[model samples]
Target: MTQARITIDRDFTVAEVPRRLFGSFVEHMGRCVYSGIYEPGHPEADARGLRQDVLKLVREMGPTVVRYPGGNFVSGYNWEDGVGPVEDRPVRIDGAWHTIETNAFGLHEFVEWSKEAEVEVMEAINLGTRGVDEARALVEYANHPGGTYWSDLRRKNGAATGTQQDPFGIKLWCLGNELDGPWQIGHKTADEYGRLAQESAKAMKLVDDSIELVAVGSSSRQMPTFGTWEHTVLSHTYEEVDYISMHAYYQEHDGDAASFLAEGVDMDAFIDGVIATIDAVKAAGKHSNQVNISFDEWNVWYQRGLDGEDQPHNVAKAGWREAPRVIEDTYSVTDAVVVGSLLHSLLRHGDRVTIANQAQLVNVIAPIRSEAGGPAWRQASFWPFARMSALAKGQIMQLAVDSGKTPTAKFGDVDAVDATATWDEQTGRLALFLANRSMEEGAEVSVDLRGLSASGVRSAEVLTIPEGGDRNSANVLDAQDTVGLKTLQEVGIEDGVLHVKLPALSWSVLELDVERA
Candidate 1:
């Protein structure tokens, strides 16, 4: 058995847990929109074409904010196409995903759906093919309360139309999505994107000064222009934007499970590097305002697979189809553990990473999967996200984990036992998220609540490959119950210590009624 110990002091804390940290993305790609979230004829769909089954799952996952209408789709999207009567909405060719985009679900539908899902809308503007005028118009249309050109148009379009047609009042906005990448539509150099984002942000803010803006950061840490891109972009729009965007997708390449399991180490490094770059630019520019991170698009995507966008896509060769399946990577227990660890990384760095949306929240690399005209079920990755979003509250408690190391090809020598905790003073709750990366042994883990006393264990659950099940096993469309969280029944506190046994390659969550001494 592998042994590990963690010491957590209630007083030694990170920052308060930002609610937006438990966010998800909804892009107009593949089945994410048409059949995923909006299936008009689905047995459980509402009158508005919103899938009640999917909405139930979404609400259960507890995403606080949702970024809408693009990953690459937004770059070439004309917002005007998605508004007005459903019959009148244009059916256009979406170059981003090589699909026919029937603008059935647009800005108005999204805002309505957001209300049903009980999440704030994090809107992204088009700086790729469009510019400042469109950005300002979007802000005006979504925000302005009364009689004006865009606001009047919004009212005329019958948006929440009745006695009191209200504005969406969306607060958070992204300047663009991944313009730093060569793959992005209307891709721009760091300086070019910086200038466009800055001016657009300026104009948008002029329309509605209350709105918060996020500038475009690099698509990934591995981007050739990563550091320089952030520096140049921040140098230009640091004052204008409240946050900068970051996107990343991880997958196990060549079947290296050990390296794949240590994904949190890479995530931690990526966040730290971004923070360092942000600070460097701040120091050079001598700015007082802090620019936080909106890690808007992130997940374990199998981007090299057939459905991945990395493949050579010929729109002309393959006839454009509506809502064609794309990048819908089915996750396994191994993937789920990595995802839980990644969530720990984000929670550990909660001070800087205020907003994080797991990419393509429905069918495309999402926690909840729904089949067209069928049922919606929780993926293996869903349990951790749902549990963490529910458990983490108040402040993120900094933990001192003393554990042995595990060697891997990608991120060398990561801790065998990794953990993070949250302390909610008002609720008198302490939640611990732990990961055991050892593939061949159970871990005898002890958590030292040195300055605290636990009343009792509220809940303890662990996600691992079930007995007689392989780690690669998944909950596909047919057999949707292959992998899920099982109760960790043998957990207790004795003399200021929490003792629990974690199986190899597992992710666990425990909640306790804890009070500071």
Candidate 2:
């Protein structure tokens, strides 16, 4: 077994854990909308037609913020089409996903669902085909409290009646979604997008100055215009926008599991690169208001195996199918480990990357899976995310690790054991999230808690493939325990030292209370 040591001190903290960091996405594509979150006649559905089973799981997962409407779907979406009465709504073709949009679920419906799920809505506007006027109008209709044109219209539409929280109360808004990609409906050059975003942001804030705006960065770090796109866009909209968006998807390719396991290395680099770009622009422009990263879209999507090299653009060639199954990649145990590592990367950078949403909430590469009219179940990726969301709180503690290095095809030399620590000073609780990246051997981790007046462990859990189980094992509706997190009974804390054995290619969470001297 490989051995490693981790040292954490309460005085050395990165930042307070941003509550918005535990966020999820819900786009109007695939089964994510129709049979996913809303199924009017499902046996488990509530009065609002939202799946009660799914809502229960979502609540258990504890996402603080939820981004609404569109991955690519928002680029050409018309906000007016999805408001007012559902019977009066229009049925149009979603050109981005090549799917027919019934417009049954819109802004009002989303707000209703978000209330049930107990999550704040992060709204995204359509800058792909529409612009400043429409964006500003949306803010007026959703936020303003009566007496005006749009707000009065909202009252007439019955959206403000019988609710303590009237006018939607949405604060975070996205200027556009992936506008730099050529595949977008009204894709534009960096200069063009920057000007449009700036104007739209200015107009929207005029209607409601309390709202925070996010400008599009790059669709992916691999984009040809990655750094340049950020620089140019920030040059124009830096003063108007509060955050820049980031979207990324990772997958194991061609039997290269080793490199794929170290996905955090790539994620760290991507975030650092964007930070450098933002700093460069800030220095050049000498702006006062600070800009942070809103990583609104991220997940482990099996893009390569989906169709072809053009998988993301593989919209329904069979013509407009409503709620058709698309890119529903079944996650494995290995994928869950990589996801845990990715979460570590995000938490490690909590100082700047304030808001992050794990792509889609259900049926579209999400942690929770639901079958239409069938039962809902947890996927392999669900355990790590759920545990991290519930256990991690307060401030992120800085961890220094001394470990053996492993050479990979990519990322060169990476530590065999990667871990992150969280210290909640208010509750006197400390949690450690650890990942063992080795494919063949277990890791013995020695945690130094000397600086802390620590008590006994509250709980310790680990997720991995069982003795007879394959790494590809995943949970189904009936067999929910196939690849789930189980308690680690062998962990011990002796003389301020934590000793635990991490199974190969697994993720673990260890928690305990601390008392200050």
Candidate 3:
């Protein structure tokens, strides 16, 4: 196999990227909520039952906004069940995962956790099985500052301190979660969901106009209602809603790393398709507001099926008496590469894609892993996300890379290298994240810094494992340590081109601290 080369030109610039595009999601599914963030008696837990260790790690991830309450779990969930006293909370069957949901962690708990983690909440209301009234009630409860029944109920539930105590100051909201899939509890057709979403959004806005609403788009690019769903939903609610939500998950069940790496190529097209649909809605001439996208749910999940029939839901629940960690997929090196590519794609399209979340936060296909009563450790996926979240501030610079192609089962021959660049003008630092998806050969990359003249490269870090498909095999209880970034020597400018070597099947971040010209 021949080596590929990537060139990043600093002259190309997109709009001033919104910082909220790098947001994350935390659902109430599996251990993501129960044991993941809200375990009360864990050695590291606090007075509010949130694990402080986990909170510290999440704060480091630098999530600007977090979507809450559900993925598929929201369709069947009643937000009212999770509030009030723990003894009054009901144990309901979670139809999405076929497990019992002990309503121990609810709306108030998530708000508290968001506060502790120092992130804003992107709340979602139940639209499937429930209607506009419940949705409006949730908004009034969270956003309204007293003078009403719901706000008074919140005060009674212990959120009363000051004017700022209202967690409903939440800026973003999703109308519902995945109402198009057959797996959804009250799955509706395009017309049904679009109309319901419009009404819900209208009512929600009446309660709080400052809050932005995201209409439910297709669950995936391959869904039966892919283009039709977005077109219809936007046609109905485009005027009332601020953005549309999209969800997708990457899986390599055939165990083809090459094919898995190529999945991101589809993600690129999927995002473009969504953007086209958004433009189509604008052309329809019903509204003046531009609808952005919230890729609220995404990540690689497909580990449990390989381990057997998911341990029989009820039996698995019985195994751990309290807050059992479930649906956790220990990430692999390949997963890290895909994640890097996804992040790059989000940055590249930062103009319209406002918010992006990496599925779950902990225990459930997340970057951080936690044991029920044991220590929490950063998974392999954590390094790239944390580094990007920390350094991916300021303006996003559009990068042009020319590279060779690698064929896959899903996507035909595709580029082996994908990358994005960010310039922190204040700090005088250029951050470049690159992923070389070649299974056989490395990338001989060239950096063409156009607008900003740099004297020399400051530092380079590459995150890779010895084996191509290496995974984190250590159980949650064990001390888990996987491969991470290793720093490289600075690159000197030669003929206005700064060159660096990117390893095959590797994810790298290059930080160039330049002297201002």
Candidate 4:
């Protein structure tokens, strides 16, 4: 077994656990919308045609905020098409995904669904095909109280029911989705996007200054325009937008599991790069308002398989099918462990990366998977997310881990054991999230809980491939429960030190009742 040590101090904290960090994304892509979240004929669907089983599972996953309408789909979307009665709504070709959008479930329906799932809406506007005027109109339609054309139209359209919160009280907004990517609808050069985002944000805020807007950064860290795109966009929209958006999707290529397992190291580097750019722009422009990150799209997607050889440009060729299956990468224990590591990266950078939405919450590379008219089940990746979101509260303690290094092709040398901890003073609880990246050896970890005593373990669960199984082992539709999370038995505390034996290539969450000494 590889040995590792972690020291966590309450005073050396990163920041309060931003509840929005546990957000998820829902796009109008593939089956994510129609058959995934809304299927009227499905036996388990609610009266509103939403899959109750899916909603139940989503609520269990406990996403605090859900970004909606599109990944690429939002670029070409017209806000008006999705309002009023379902029958009256127009059917249009979703140029982003090359699909026929029925407009059956639009803004009103989404807000209703969000209420049912008990998650906040992180709305994204259309800057690709439309611009500032449309964005401002959207703000007025969703937010303004009454008397105005859009607000009165919102009432006439039947969004007057939920929560009595004026303008639906939707606070977070995305200016657009991945505008830097060539594949994006109305793809913009960095200058084009920055100028557009700035003006759009300015106009939307004019409608309702209470809203927080996110400017689009690079679609992926690997994009050729990554650093320059961020710098240019932030340089222009720094004062106007609250956060900058990032989107990334990772997959194991050419059987590079070792490198794939250490993907979080890359994520950390990506966060660092974006932060550096943000700070540089801030320093040069002499601005005080901190521009944070909204990692609105991050997931493990099998892009090669999903997009054939032409990959990024394949969406245009997918034909005009409504809700065609796309990029639904079934996850394995390995994927789940990597996800846990990514979560560790996010928590470690909690001070700046305040909002993160795991892309496509339901069917497309999501933690929870639902079958139309069938069963909805938890994916292997679901356990860590659900557990962390539930148990990690209060402040993110600054955790330092010392461990042996592992060599990988992509990220060079990374720690065999990656970990993060949260200290919740109100509940008298401390939660530790740990991931072992080693493929062959279990990690013996000793955790130093400075100025805190672990009274007892509240819960400890580990997700690992079962004996005789390897990394490729996954939770399929029929065998969903077979590969889920299992209890971690080898855990104990002694003399203010917590000891845990993490299985090779596993994700573990250990929650303990702690008291200040």
Candidate 5:
């Protein structure tokens, strides 16, 4: 077995753990909306037609913020189509996912669901076909009090009822989604998008100056115009916007599990590269206000095997079908491990990358999966996310690792053992999230805790390939226990050292109480 050592100190702090870092996305695509979160007749549905079981799981997952109404769907969406009376709402074709969209669930419905799930709403507007005028109108409709035309429309739409619905007060908004990608419905050049985003941001802020706006960055690091895109966009929209957006999805290709497991290495590089780009613009413009990254869309998605299409596009294909199943990837043990390590990469960069949403939050590449009339259960990737959301508080600590290298085809040789920790001084909680990327052998990992006040292990849990199980095994449909969180009986805190038995291709969480040191 290979061995690794980790050293963490409270003094070596990265940044305060941003609650929005654990955010999620809810888009109008496929079963993600119709049967995904809103099935009026489901056994577990509430008065609002949202699945109570999914809300329960979402609450358990503890996402602090959720972006609404788009992936590429927002690029072609009209805010007016989803508001007012559900009967009067438009039944439009969502070209993004090639599915029918019955606007039964829109801004008000999502705001109501957000209240039930206890999450902040991150709204996105249509800057693709529409521009500054529509963005301004949306801000007025959602945030303005009575007396205005848009606000009156919202009042007529049922948000004026005295149940704390007057002003939705949604603070964070996305100017557009993936405008740089050619697959988008109304793709624009960097200069075009940057100029549009700037004007829209200005108009929206005039309606509600207290709100924060996110300008579009490159869709992903692999884009042909990655660095140049951000530079051009930020050059135009830097001062008007508070944050720039980043989106990425990782997947294993051509049986390259070894390289896929080391996805965090690539993630770290991508984040650092973006930070460099953002700072370059800031330095050139000499902007006083700081603009950080809002990594709004990210998750492990299998885009290759979906259709004959090489990439995810916003083109119409499935005629007109409502609630069609699209890109519903059943995550496995290995996928869960990669997700945990990706969370580690996000946490380690908490200072700059303030807001992150895990792609689509429901049946579309989410942590919690639910069927139309079936049951809702946690996926294999849900455990680490839930555990970290529940326990990771206060500041993210810098971790020093001395570990062996794992050779990979993609990311060169990455550390075999990757980990990150968050320390909360108020609650006396120190939570450690670890991942073992070794595909062949188990690892013996020890964490040096000499600087800590030293408390016994509170709880240790791991998700690994179960006995007589394959690495690709998943908790799908009715059979829920293929690979889930199981207690790690082989962990202990011995004399300022945390010894954990990490099986190959595993993700583990260790939580313990320690006084501030």
Candidate 6:
């Protein structure tokens, strides 16, 4: 076991990390939209059928914006099928996960729930089956004030019942979801998707200029079209769209702990590749408008294969109500360490990456899990996400850390000490998050407060368990418990450098009060 050290300099300053970068995603698949967030009969449900408990958790997560409705499910979705009266809402077959869509909770319900959760809605259009017309109508319905066709329809549906509220004020909209992959219902070639995205974005913006559109890029780094997909798509829609959407998920397929720890390198490389791609597109077009990347879908999945037998397609329908807890990953301490590294990577690239969401918000491969008519539990991945959301804000600071590298299955050799820093201007505080990926030994880190000097360290919090690989042993009704922010202690500043000890295979968040010297 080797020890690593990290040193932060106060003189180095980087881009300001946008608060919206901490956003998350919520889909209708599995329990994410059903019992997970909209259980009408639940004791904590509100008038619109949103679960108050889930809302409370969402508020705690402090997601700036939430991507709604579908993953692969959005490709085959029909926007009109989900609107209007509940009784008349049609029941369609969900081809993405082989489930039935009740259509009971549609666009209206989601908007109301977003208001209740105190988060902005990031809507994705159905480019798989539907196209520009449907996308335009949906945008008009949400952002158009009144005196228009869709806005009037929204009024008819009770979205405009009181005080002339602007029915269509949604600011963010996705052009489509995952159109580059073969698994998608309406997968398109780079040329096809680019052209479609250009046309759709043009029409969407024409309808509402204030709204921003995100074009679909590669789904993951391993995709055959990873870099090329982004280059070609951005080439055509460079002037039309505001951001390019990227999706990636990490999984320990061979069950190697070391392999899982190195996945963050892949995430870092993915973001860098996309950033270069965006720059290339801008250079090629000689366009002044800079486009950013949206990591709208990302998390650790693949636990389903290990837990139970894969259900056959024929039996999937019957299992809809049962849901059977598909992809319910019981995250271990190792997963948290990797997630911390990923969050660090996002903050490091905060300038180019504006919006990011952790795949599904609840149940199906998510941080929050629940059983129908039962209590919910936070997974091991939940703690770091909650902590980052709470502590990560303001400007991003570049950290200089000296560390070694280790080879692994998925990401090859990667740095052992991975971290990033954020400074909150309003609170006059600096927050540093670190992930020690070494499996055998802890790292003694020395951090230098750059630019702004502090009198003394305010707090140092560690989120770790006794057993390095220990997982959260929580059930539906059991008391949800796991390792999180165990301590916050004041530290002495030695020669303007603060020394702190970070546990091996652990994640630590240190907060310091900053003052101008």
Writing each residue's lDDT as its tens digit, candidate 2 over 75-126 gives 9999999877788889999988788999888788788889899999999999
- Model 3 per-residue lDDT tens digits across residues 1-517: 4345545455567756677876788887667777688788999998778999899989887888888887877888899888887777888877666677888788888887888888889888888899899988988888899989998887777533222345457778889889998868889999999999999999988988988998999999989879999999888998899889888888875667788887778788999999999998899876678999999988887755545444334434354333344567777677788888888888888898888988888887888888778888887778778888878866788777777787787787888888888887788888888888886887777777766777667678877764433442322346366466677543456876677777777788887775434
lDDT of every predicted structure (CA atoms): 0.89, 0.89, 0.79, 0.88, 0.88, 0.78
User: How big is the positional error of residue 149 in model 4, measured in Å on the Cα after superposition?
Assistant: 0.7
Candidate 1 on 1-517: residue-level lDDT in tens? 8789999897799999999999999999878998899999889998888999999999999999999887789999999998887788889998887889899888888988998999999999888999999999999988998789999988888643221247889999999899988878999999999999999999999999999998988888899998899999999999999998888888889989899888888889999999999999899999999999999988898766554342325433567888876666789999999899999999999999999999978987888888888899889999889999999999898899888888899878888998999999898999999899989877888999867889899999999988899888788889898998899867988887999999988999999998877
Candidate 1 backbone overlaps, count: 0
Clashing pairs in 5: none
- The candidate 6 region of ten consecutive residues with least summed lDDT is 467-476
lDDT of 6 by residue, 128-217 (tens): 988889888888888887898888888777633222245747888888888988979899999999999999999999988988889998
**Worst window of 10 by summed lDDT in candidate 1:** 307-316
User: What C-alpha lDDT does candidate 6 achieve relative to the native structure?
Assistant: 0.78
Each candidate structure's TM-score, on Cα atoms with residue i matched to residue i, is: 0.97, 0.97, 0.93, 0.97, 0.97, 0.93
Q: Which stretches of candidate 3 lie over 4 Å from their true place?
A: 1-7, 159-167, 303-307, 311-325, 467-479, 515-517
The sequence of per-residue lDDT tens digits that candidate 5 reaches over residues 63-134 is: 999999887999999989888778888898777767677898888888888999999999999988899999
**What C-alpha lDDT does candidate 1 achieve relative to the native structure?**
0.89
The lDDT of model 5 is: 0.88
After superposition, candidate 5 runs with Cα above 4 Å error: 159-164, 305-317
What local lDDT score does residue 489 receive in model 6, on the 0 to 100 scale? 39
Question: In model 2, which regions exceed 4 Å deviation?
Answer: 159-165, 305-312
Cα error, candidate 1, residue 383 (Å): 1.0
TM-score of 2: 0.97
